[model samples]
Target: AYTVRESTVFYVRVPAPHARFATDLLCEVVGQPRLDPADVEIERGVILGELDGALDTPDDVVFMNLVEALFPGHPIGRETLGDPQSLVAMAAADIAGFHDRWYRPQNLVFAAAGALDHDEIAKTIDAHFDGRASGVRPERIAPGEALGSDKSAQRPIEQAYLALGWRGLTATDPDKVALAVLNHAFGDGPSSRLHEEIRERRGLAYEVSSSAASNLDAGTQTVYCATAPEHLDKVRRIIDEQIEAIVTDGIDDEELAVAQGYLTGSMLMALEDSSSRMSRLGSAVLTHGRAIPIFESLESIAKVTTDDVKRVAERIFGQQHVESIVSPDGDEFDDDDED
Candidate 1:
């Protein structure tokens, strides 16, 4: 059982005579057990293959490029799966140390839910973790370097995926709710601004939308579109033009009302699922030290004004913010030319 701010993940693993209690337990041993170096190499190879698989997908590659640009110097910016060179450079000791530092009892929360008896789970956890000493705090990681280059490529993919992004408000900012509502209107679902402008009106691409990334320290909002090789440059220009329009004329009353309703509806729907509720609780705990009730978030969304959305957009989508472009190997069009 593991408990977060307002949620929990309970686990009950039966230990057997020859079976290890946990795989990460190896890191807890008093001394470095003689590990076969060959086995480590094999595992590294498997991970490398997985990285290759992710890169092979166009959408994944584009999003990873965005992350690299958005979080240039940060660990969160670091690929979830480290790059080939980075993985190859890792020693067995490094893996052991990382596991020991991050997987400690103090860093964990035991939680249980559903029909399970709380006392029995608590007793089991106490039996297993009672005497275990807390580990040292993990070292803080630095911010990722911001994306600067106008163009990037992973050549083998067939389609071109592009993103024009801007830095946004942090999760705790008062305008976060406003920003979410704005983003929903701009490009959240099929009825969004980008979808209406780029896909429906002009047939620029098969898919187009915008989204926001929110966290305790910072946040970002991006307008993204995908088009075929022949239509790439036009799609980029259209996206930029639409963004400029949003910044200038501001949104109309009708658009604002639509965005408000859609955002409110989405929020209401999100809470209907148990897993989402649990996730909401856990994320609040992780990000803000406690969970914010569902009603609290809904109220925030409902109260957002058009002026608030416009102000957030102006602050977030500034000219100086980061930009990223990823294309297939030998494209003639240059993303930097637009700058």
Candidate 2:
């Protein structure tokens, strides 16, 4: 999908011998989509339904709200499933024009994984896609100020969903590895600090996790939690307290080692599958303009020292944060963004 903060990736996987056929098929579809008016209306209905379903889920709603509040005026902040009114107003001719303007050769990339002859595939691509003259990629949306203020909505639900987000390093930032280590140690899994404190010890939240999203030019680190409406205050406090402690005390050797191993091991394990490899290939290329081997990725993780993690933790978490709350009254959390 085309997005503001990240590159749009088109990917497909096929058996070794079927790679050429798959490439040819994808080109035909992209270069000449059958945009019948009937088909357009049908797809619009399907997409709108999916979007409506996503909004009903508390967590999804909270996350989408956070993205909107964080990247205001940017393409990333645009409605996830496109605007309902816009879709309804759109015509088949408009869709075709939009496609023609943006679906240029320069904007697309061809990538494959698994057993295949690179030369043969390249030749096949040239034969099938030749004369599809290269054109400029879609203009990247420049970022504006992130709305660091807190935003809350009244949802009349049993559980409250909260997301606390901070600006993060770009994909190629030197501290990216350290940031990954910081994320893993904070709340990536059951053993993470957020889970250990928010769920295991306090029994406050039913779900809690942290995520790092990096794009070509901008990035974010977010912590998500859902708990009984009554426990929302405690959950929010503990999250802030834990982050402050990390910035002040830093991570220990044991914690740092665990994070490094987990990060590297996960990368290694994912590469064993063709689907993972294909995704990694496309995303890596889009982010770094090249594919980084698994070993190189592991090495990068291994080199993230304790100090690196500590410094990055302080730098990222110390920024003004965007907080989002979805609860019955929108009255439980602070309206002011916290640092």
- Best candidate (score: TM-score): 2
lDDT by residue for model 2 over 231-253, one digit each (tens)?
88889899989999999988999
Local distance difference test, each candidate: 0.66, 0.81
Local lDDT at 189 for model 1: 82
The superposed Cα distance between candidate 2 and the true structure at residue 232, in angstroms, equals: 0.7
Ten contiguous residues with the weakest lDDT in model 1: 18-27
Give one digit per residue, the lDDT tens place, for model 1 in 1-339. 333212234333334331233322322332234445677789899889988888776676666767667766675555667788889899888877765565566665543223345465556555656677777655555454355454466455567788766666676788887777777777888877788878898887888889887765656677777778788888877777877877776677777788778777877897775455546665677667676876787778778777887887777776465555556667764442211
Q: How accurate is candidate 1 locally (lDDT)?
A: 0.66
TM-score of each: 0.79, 0.93
